[model samples]
Target: MFSRAERKGLRLAGGLTLGFVLCFAGVAAAVLLGHAESGDGGPLLDPYLVRVARFTLWQAALSTLLSVALAIPVARALARQRRFFGRVWLLRLAVVPLGLPALVAALGIVEIWGRQGIVNDLLHLAGLDNPVSVYGLAGILIAHVFFNLPLAARLMLAALDRIAPEHWLTAANLGMRGPALFRLVEWPAIRRVAPGIAGLVFMLCATSFTIVLTLGGGPAATTIEVAIYQALRFDFDPPRAVLLAALQILMTAALLGLIALIGRPDEEGATAGRPIRRFDGRHRRLSDGAILFLFAAFTGAPLIATLTAGLSADLGRLALDPLLHRALATSLAIAFASASLCLLLALPVVMTPRLADRGGTDATTRFLARALPATGSLILLVPPIIIATGWFLILRHFGDTTRHAPAIVAIINALMALPFVVRVLEPAFRTHLARTGRLALSLGVTGANRLLRIDLPALRKPLAMAFAFAMALSLGDLGAIAIFGADGFVTLPWLLFSRMASYRTADAAGIALLLGFLCLLLTLPSASAEPETKGRGNA
Candidate 1:
């Protein structure tokens, strides 16, 4: 527990986090109003964009429902079992999607579900004119299920784990099975987590960018974020871009509101209910085995496809592409710089969270820093293409389009991703500082050296984790790069998109694999950090 000052600081931190999230949500809401004057490419509440939104809504809802629904059975089975071969592996797989880059996953989906991809190739040998449709609505749903099922399973399993072992014993004694067992043991778990899972999957689908873009065949299959991209990047219509940003904001906000209304009624004691027992009967064995197999297929196929393609390819050719190399270097540089920036900013924020509090921050500074991230996010929420267009317009007026635009994109990318870094690192920062503040002061350590010697040693894990996460996110990004990417400022993911558009499946597949591996390498360090660092005091 915090002392009064500490409590005030923690409150401020919460306020700031909420405020930041809400501000972004609000900006996403007024997209229509902002782009009311987006001439030419302006949405004008057009049928095309409306169709896109509707499709996004339908596909995402279905995906969310399927994922959460399927997760119930899978979760229950896992919760009931003891440690088994590949059990931990499956749980880890459930969490792998959490680390998945959307673009990478899309590529894997194509390989498995694409027309000329594996499934289709097999189908062709079987003499089918057309194989499965990995395009349009079908493609979008496949990608979502592929991505969200693991998350839902993980959540549901966590929820079901709450059931007490005694419950299972009592059920056995009473001869409970089937619906009776489900009602007594499962429904409660489902009720507790259903709303949250729904909200998570829904928001994920709603705000989707990469999956919809890659899998979506065209404008007919677009999402709001993609729409914002089209208006700004493709058309350079500021008002339209603003309007789309607003619409996105509103839709995202509405989804979040739904979450709040139907929020996880059972977040507390999610694992309070039961001790997951090993299978003791044929029925139990069958149910558990089926669930494991279903989820394994859902979660494992993408990785297998990616590994097969990536490892089987001409990586040499892919790497030789100058643009690919440039993007790789650029991603690393920005990731490093931004990671440093997050650490610098987070250290202060965590140590002095009171600054975020109305009581602590001066009204003026609070207002300034509080809203500063948007200065960078201005590209996205306001439309990146609009910002680029306005800047381009200014340059054109001055007849100086020669100014470096790619630099601007890199800066924006760093800024846009900064908030995420801050969000992830700030908690660990506060927790550490609050607990170790006196220890550090008593040891007479302060300033830069303090960070390296006193703080960094303890913070090495989260620090590494935050840096890796920021880098991985930045690496997979196409948003900022797209605006300034015209002159070939291509990142690996961008390159893959280009290849896909040009029908270069082989090359695109290779790049996707490379990019996925790169992202995983960057992310693994941080993922590995959490278990290694926490609640430990060091000199």
Candidate 2:
């Protein structure tokens, strides 16, 4: 459907994506092979590795099951109560955790459930001798649920919203009530979408880094990602790090493949043009009210604690601290650079011509054109720690890796943000092209002229939104920073984590609140304007 120029654009875009992927793979291979040649090669399946892997799987499974199971009642309650006050705000709050930095959220959790936190303080005031500990397995599970439960509830709530009004009417006419109504109408809706949500949550929990590190408490709670970090950073054992990285990649790939087989939850095509009148859930106000109140409290308590603790912190002193200023400046610089890089990388794939336009193209060309975006998104399957480990090993051979740590971290952060940038930009880019591509072509406009004069102006808003999201994501990331942070290379999350690890709770709480506020501020522009219907069942 395009002139010769468009095809050339497509080819260049495809080549760039392929080259990026190959460069990453090449670095990883070099690291693994280099270590194998020099180190005393032992079997990959050491006892510790085996134990960590088993614990990783076990925790992820339990986390997924709990998040989904708990989401059911919350979602069902929201679905039935249609016109309650503050409902929209409540829904918006459910998405706040998605944008929060894991470490910030972990700090928030600690402020609520730690030994000196509100819960334990209340218990002590009541003359109870027992106090709570927000560390170890309990801490990990609580943090995971705090982050993932709202996501699961939102997805399940969206599924419930999709059920037809006709079905509800039929059930009512048949005198269906309570268990019977759920059996006939609700269960099927949840079942259809539950598998995909479970898999997504499982993958997330399995690859968890910041939460695991913050709450792990000891070696018994170590995850594969943490093990890889220890092998490289603490032991200086590249061979072992490489082995663990390879295992993580293999396990994640398997989970992703299984998710594909189960199919994605139906997230698109939600209609808000008309309202549905519901016949059920009219007489169960007491139960539904209790459910809603409990979940709201569960999700809201930590955030409230964070805010209260942060309010009591000495912000004036923190402002004058050189370390905080340096870390803040570094984080801003990295966020800006990474956001720009991600947009540049995502544009080509987003602008690739659709396959339907390949009227005269050969099969191979069409296939490559279609595969380019998939390749870009496939970067998600390779955990950021794995990429960082590979590059860290490679840089060690040439010189001190510390010198290049910040730059390396920025690149990995950009790559991790690529999938989100693509998701945000692709739809808007495609829609703009569908409207203007033929017109621009007919006017003999192509390449820079078309992009500058037509596409850019029309897509300015979405492009900005994508940039903001990418920037926020990079700013909050701990994965790459965890591997690279050192004396002269501290970022905000790194500094905050150090404070928390050293038992400087007051300073940590201040930094956590600051980081959380920054992320929320960056996310507001997009969140306010975007429709709630999009990405309904997606985490």
Candidate 1 segments whose C-alpha is farther than 4 A from its true place: 1-44, 121-130, 267-282, 354-423, 439-453, 528-539
Tell me, by lDDT, which candidate is best: 2
For 1-539, candidate 1 gives per-residue lDDT tens digits of: 23454445444654564454345434433444444654565436788667867877888888898878787778777766655687766766666666667878888888888876877888899998777998888888888888888777666665555556666677888888778888876788578767877887887787677788788888778887787677766786667666655566667667766776884363433234443463444567777888789779867888898888877878888778887788677667755665565455444444444345445555644654455444333333433333443444344445535355545554445555555666666677677767776676666665555667867888787777767776677777776555555544556767778888788877877888888888888875444221111111110
TM-score of each: 0.80, 0.94
Q: Residue 222 in model 2: shift from native, Å? A: 0.6
lDDT of 2 by residue, 386-457 (tens): 888888877777777778887888778888888888878878877887898789889998878877898889
Query: What's model 2's lDDT at 8?
Result: 72
For residue 132, model 1's alpha carbon misses the true position, in angstroms, by 1.6
Predicted structure with the largest TM-score when compared to the true one: 2
Write out the backbone clash pairs for model 2: none
